[model samples]
Target: MSGRSAAARVDEADYIVVGAGSAGAALAARLTEDPDVTVLLLEAGAPDTALELHVPAAFSKLFRGPFDWNYDTVPQPALEDRTVYWPRGKTLGGSSSLNAMMWVRGFAADYDEWADAAGPAWSWEALVPYFRRVERTEDPADPTQGAAGAQPIEHQRDPRPQTAAFLDAAREAGHRVTAANLPAGQGFSRTMVSQHRGSRSSTADAYLRPANGRPNLRVVTGALVRRVTFEAGPDDPAVPRATGVYLEIDGITRHARARREVILCGGAVNTPQLLLLSGIGPAEHLGERGIRIVAHSPEVGEGLRDHLVAGLAPAARGGTLYAAEKPAELANYLLRRRGMLTSNVAEAYGFVRTAVADRIGMAADLPDIEIIFASAPYVGEGLVPLPAEGLTVGAILLRPRSRGTIRLASTDPRDKPLIDPGYLSDADGIDAETLRAGLAACEELIDTDAMRTVTTGGWIQPAGGEHMTPVERAELAMRRYSHTLYHPVGTARMGTDSSSVVDPALRVRGVSGLRVADASVMPNLIRGHTNAPAIVIGEVAADLLRGRSSSR
Candidate 1:
């Protein structure tokens, strides 16, 4: 059920933030720190009280459930015309609650790339303090990692035996094994997770929960935001000022007026959808849906990018997470917080500078591929359990040249947006070539002595035996069995150019009193995971909004 009905009637606030997910939760919490500012956070889903949400290894169980947005992509021609499953969190913490919880900050050079697009303020140098301000790492060995912040991050308390073997293989294969989230952003290591005392610590737990006692903060769950309410700007009538939002709480439609600003943190998928629904998208696209155009922004839902991974699950001997759900293991987890249940599935990760486009100077020294090790068979897109004992070696394309879009499916707010990641559809074929190189690395890792100790030496996934050639296997993995790492960004790209959806400060270019603070505003993708970066975006957005003296 939705939250308190009495608060549904409570409307006006100093600030209105939509989608109490990663960015919105952190922003609303930080905004209310003023005590004088009244902040309203509207979530389209239920509370983050699900038992599955708190369990580190139970993340896949939340997929396709009520707690998930459960989106699917249009059939991709490059991927054997298979529609990929895209599971976004629909709860308080948003995807952070449902993610594998890896706190991987990409290389310093990658954020320097952000400096090229946006301003130097987004550079790795300038954003490091914001990154530091977002996380409270349990024991940060690296100077780049934050030691005192809201988010709780730590090394896994109990990783699977196979996970350690995976890192051993990385080192044995001559890959550097180093600490996580270093500014250099090279090498392999045991993943640092967003957890506290072996339990998942989402933005809801880290940011929102602590701020709940504040008198000025009102968090509304199950509140479906329909569209942004706007009026004529005082300075320019052609430019609209976001007055507030029109949302449905329970059954009745209500208006929540924002005296200062309206921020959209619905993420890469929903933020663009909400913007398009509010008549702030392409003039022709809004015309097709019979929506009145408020702004003619053409780039609202364009430039969608995500991390596409091809997972290879090989048959394994005993000692994997295959028995993590057994009664004794559950008891071990509940009693002492030590067991396989504390595993984040994808336990260890490494970066690879593939041979593709390296000599040509295309993305030189940047990680073009990522290697992920999960000590379980992540078959059926995680819709089912590990049928037998197996370990997954996932090869992910780190820098995708392919860009897609998130478009409106219908005028109704309930209808999910049309998401087309266009996986591996890059014109130069570099994306496909990079993934093939990642597949070769996975094969190399699997052949190492460290990995040979655990595996039984056969394929469990790709729906076949180990009879296929390496070339054939790599091609098959690319054509099929590929899924998202759940890092979608760059839809509402932030840049210094006028063509960008939002400015470097994250304000919507043609709108007043409106901004987007989510993965959607990323000018481009990072070389690592998106969860930590999304939280950092929220932290920076809070500072920017606080510094503003007048409406645009």
Candidate 2:
């Protein structure tokens, strides 16, 4: 093992990207295309070339293990005083490798809303080309869709029998099912996952690994960035420019200089926390904490948001749905990369608009809730102890009405930050209502001729002949099973306003030679999973840094 001291290598690079996760990998790969530019990517986690990472069925195993930065949230009020566990990947690919691999390009209007809130360049019309550039959609040249890029997007192979039955039930419930990514009408549809053949196509696999061999790119693992080092000129007291970063490795601290820019790709929580730790947040807050205030930006850690979902455990007709049951299926996966192991568990999905979207005149494209039909329920707590049998249908509220924040529990980077995602905090919060709609939709499936053959009974919480009304069931569901969609964003929002941390160009407010190119820059949460959009942000930011004029 070659352990180089950070102090010995205080060399400068054209760019220093913190957090070698999804956005960081893409940004590093794109920027290093120019052979003259030297790029250094620092990650707190190890690399992701393990065979376990390649096996699609082993995703859950990666959670809370060495690869994951397992952080627990404060007890959520809406979740019956339950502290939700957040498993973010701390490896080379970050959450992209550990995630369920659901490839969701958020609603078209979600980007349009960005444009409406921030600037014209962020609109769907502006960002679609970039989305297309980063992804190789499975169904290319379908007019409404196409795939011609690095990331491979495809439909699940050998979906479970229960998946097909669930779709049939959704159809019988009077919802429309379609093959499109952002399908029309309300109902269930198959999920389009981020997989090529059978392996997960993470940004690390698609972008970083290929670029790793380049001489100009240097990747340092297990390097935890502590704070941004600043230089204060005698004349300028308010604007202290960031020249480098203070990073810790194996209990030793060192500084790495950035000649051009220091990009923060540390996701929502860590990004804002980093800024605050570096004295770049609200003046009063930092001053009260006995820290010098460099930039008094109030929005550094405000406007935090995330997607919330309620999991519904349905009764299975027979034994468990573990992929290990089918030996031949496993053999096919190990041999030719084709089998049940290749399937992303949330095989079928549907997007529907609740009453809230109706009031807003949201189009069919703007789906608020995404219902995932899985072959089996992901039972057991904290990523361990698999259940012997059962099925799970997850109802995710894409456009959450509630907001939360991420603050420093202390200045120590080792200590987990305070994450408070105020789920179901809306009077018009669509979580409860949307979940009821999902339950109704699921019941519709149970009643269908196809599902009747498999489903033996109902397992709605507070079970049995109890006089619990639908409203009561919905509320109970919200309390019992509402977990994170793992899509946390908007803590360090980008806009042209004073409250914004970064501007439209992703330049951090009141700072030079620094930018943020990650999900944290989102002004609001996109109406779907965030991996695709985070990649798009990196792609677009690369173009901007390369001096390319905006086509939008």
Candidate 3:
């Protein structure tokens, strides 16, 4: 059976924003604020009306469900040919609706690096305002943190005792407890999430929902954009102008014309996929797929980067989040909006520079690894259900040296892209060695008396890791158990260099009336989760649209 309906009539709008996701939702809302601009936002998934979408703890349940794109990468050689499952939200808020709800702003130095790759306007100082504009944080350590922005960021309302123990263990292990959002932020802290009270505050909830009533704004769900429709420029026949998008809505093929611009916020994966499908990627690749070349951009799906984590689970003494699966916990969530259901799984996070990174002369401003503490055992890279009552402490590589690619599987838009996240493929093996150090830190943290008190039984993941040297165990575990943290970026990286798919202004090279404002345009992966930065990118796009000279 066909996934879409029969062809429908053409639609027209002043502007068309593809993918009502983390960036699209915000950008569409911001653009429509002008009232003069009639904006149409298209989403491939259904609306975010499900109760589970708002419940923090239920995020994992949405995976492989109707709301997820449910993408799986090609077999990774470094991870023993494991084809990692990559879950991206197919709903209005994109992955923001399905993410762990972390609101990390990323390290300042990471943005500085972006500035180097793109332009000075992308520096930390220039982007901070956009960060503040997108967030409404509560009780942030820095006064500069957003206090009254569209998205609500709240401290964890109900942190697990196991997580508290993990923090103490981190401190005992000589790790400082610092804020993850500040320039000098580092250390262990309860995670701050994009939530309102206890409910998940997705971009849909924060930006799109509020602008839902606008007459100038129109949101259509279940609209699959196949390709960007282009026309030859008036004077320059060689240059193409994106007039609109060719999409399938209600199984009906239709054209949604954009009078002004067609902005793509389809995230790191889909944005590049759409570009490639529209024949905007590598000439040879598109030719092989029988796709007519509209624009030949060789770097479209290159430079893919993602975070990988080694699971470090230990059996817990008593209290774990498993009890939340019961009826009583659901009742607690219904009545008081508190309990395990309010948890965002990975409830605590920290950034650290391991001895390996420091000794290797890596950038001191960037963290080599990030420690994530989950109240419950998250096995099988969170694809597997909780096996038992336990605590999970993951050692995540922050800045992996390896790069990957997203390529066309076929000319058909329905076909999934070929994802090759060349993880741990660095020539120097630095990515693997850095992860080893992080896993060692995880071992050090868990071995502390503070963590040991909460941990009762033996290690759940990499059972009996203590037998071998910590580095050896980490290497084994990394090869055996390392999986994506679900933060992928840089596929359609923005820069001034010839290899860049998009310029610093986010305009696709050799194309007009088209722009990309999403994680895909990030020149470098931030030293944090991609959610906050993605939203900030939307804010920056809005500012640019409003005729701002630069982000600063």
Top lDDT hit = 1
Query: Who is ahead in TM-score, 2 or 3?
Result: 3
lDDT of 3 at 426: 99
Ranking by lDDT: 1, 3, 2
lDDT for each residue of candidate 3 in 1-552, tens digit (9 for 90 to 100)? 011123323488888899988999999899889989888888888888889988999988898999999899999999999999899999889999999998777778889999999998899888877877877889867855878789999988888898888888888988888765776656778899888889999898889878878878888888899999999976787899999999887667888899988999998899999999887999999999899899899999999999998877888887789787899889999999898899998988888888888888987656888999998988876777888888888888888889999998887778889999999999999998898888888888888999989987476776775566667667767998888888899989999897799898888998888999999999887788999889888988887877864334
The residue-by-residue lDDT of candidate 2 on 147-181, one tens digit each, is 67778888787677888777877777777877645
lDDT (Cα, 0-100) at 107 in candidate 1? 87
Report the poorest 10 consecutive residues by lDDT, candidate 1.
1-10
Residue 343, candidate 3: Cα error in Å is: 0.5
lDDT of 1 at 174: 94
Quantify all predictions' global Cα lDDT against the true fold: 0.89, 0.77, 0.86
State the local distance difference test value for candidate 2: 0.77
| Residue-level lDDT tens digits of model 1 in 164-259 | 899999989999999888888479989999999899999999999899888898888888999999999999998999999999977778888999
Segments of candidate 2 deviating more than 4 angstroms = 1-10, 144-146, 183-187, 233-237, 323-330, 359-365, 380-382, 427-431, 458-472, 549-552
TM of each candidate vs. truth? 0.97, 0.92, 0.96
Model 3 earns a TM-score of: 0.96
